[model samples]
Target: MTLLNVENLRVTFRTEAGPVEAVRGVSFNLGRERLGIVGESGSGKTITGRSVLRLIRPPGKILADRMEFDGIDLTRADEKTMRGLRGRRIAMIMQDPKYSLNPVMKVGAQLTEGLRQRDGMSAADARKKAIEALEAVQIRAPERVMEAYPHELSGGMGQRVMIAMMLIPGPDLLIADEPTSALDVTVQAEVLAILDGLVRDRGMGLIFISHDLRLVARFCDRVLVMYKGKIVEELAARDLMAAKHPYTQGLLNCLPRIGGSQGPLPSLDRDAAWAL
Candidate 1:
């Protein structure tokens, strides 16, 4: 049932000075479960997620002792094979819908494009499937929404469209990179609920990358705390509040409480050795 296995995965970007290591010896196993990787901006969380799909751009190199998805070796996969798997089997819902979605394309066209590429279905069939996907994400009047452009939809609606498009191909694994970071609190909850429901109902593995520790604890099954390109702590989501690592504890204490009076949030004291 292990869907994805990454071992000793290292990613480096070629800079003018030299190679800048982004991810360092990161390894994890994902089954049909939700795994949250929580960290700050430069913690290499996003890079690790991108590396799984081999989405690293030029001058960026990904080296892994072993990187396999469902027994298929991703490190050795050709561009064509990776392309077929990228959106079809292992879809990624990026952080911002504004950049992720095509502004010129109608929502309907963009949503069904994945299905068209994967299944080669007729236009009518693709549209039907697109509508179904929109509805699946709890979008009301899916047909109307589909006809509209990305700019016409609200931020939340646009995100829903992105999710629908990603799920239209029925990917076995979903990598959600800061999915609700841009949404309001209420919209964040709604979108998380939709994602949670889909993952559970379809029994698909989810890798949610975020900087919100408390949200990850509440929404994910397992939590992996990353600091400076390494996983410093891994624990059950329920036990995240009781995490042992200093970094993890610092992150937990940083969450703002409604009733509690806080003077100043405790900043994480990073050790130089932790990066190694």
Candidate 2:
């Protein structure tokens, strides 16, 4: 059931100030279940997800003792091999559809581009599949949405479109990087529901990266808490409140609970040792 296995994974960028390690010695195994990576900004959660798909470019280096996906060695995969795996076997849903989708292309074109180019699907067949994908995400009037451009859709609609596109290929693993960060609470719930359904129905492994500790705890099966470029703790989602790490405990205490604490939320008492 283990879809991915990563050990001592490191992602570093050759900056003007010398090498900066964004992800340091992060290791985890993912099965066909939701795995949440939670942390504040610059904590390397996003980098860790991208490293699995070998998306790090030059100047940004990825190193690992072992990085495998479905028995294939990701650390040693060439660009061509990685390309085949990406989208087809391992799809990634970025933070924002506005930035991820092409501005100039229509929604239908954007959705079917991969199908036609990579899968060698014919135009009519690709269009039919694209419409089905849109429908699967609960987008009503799929044909109309497909004809519209990215700018023409609302935030929630655009996000659903993104989810639909990623699911079109029926990937085994889905890495969602703050997929609901920009949406309102209602929209966030809907998006989470869609993702949850995919995991339950399709048996797809999910790597959900987010800064919202509460949301991650609610939606994910297991949680990995990251801080200063490394995993601080890993625990079941239901046990998040009872986490043993000070970092996790500090994060939980920082959340402003309604009707519970009218006082100022506590800030993290930074520990130098947490990073080490």
Cand. 1 Cα-lDDT = 0.91
Worst 10 residues of 2 by lDDT: 255-264
lDDT of 2 by residue, 1-276 (tens): 899999999999999899999999999999999999999999999999999998888889999999999999998888899889999999999998899999999999999999999889999999999999998888889999999999999988998899999999999999999999988999889889999999999999999999999999999999999998999999999999899999999989988887886877899998999999
In order, the Cα lDDT scores of the candidates are 0.91, 0.94
For residues 47-96, write the lDDT of model 1, one tens digit per residue. Answer: 99999999999789999999999889999999998988988899999988
Candidate 1 stretches greater than 4 Å from native: none
For candidate 2, the per-residue lDDT at 88 reads 93
TM-score of each candidate structure, all chains considered together = 0.96, 0.97
Poorly placed runs, candidate 2 (over 4 Å): none
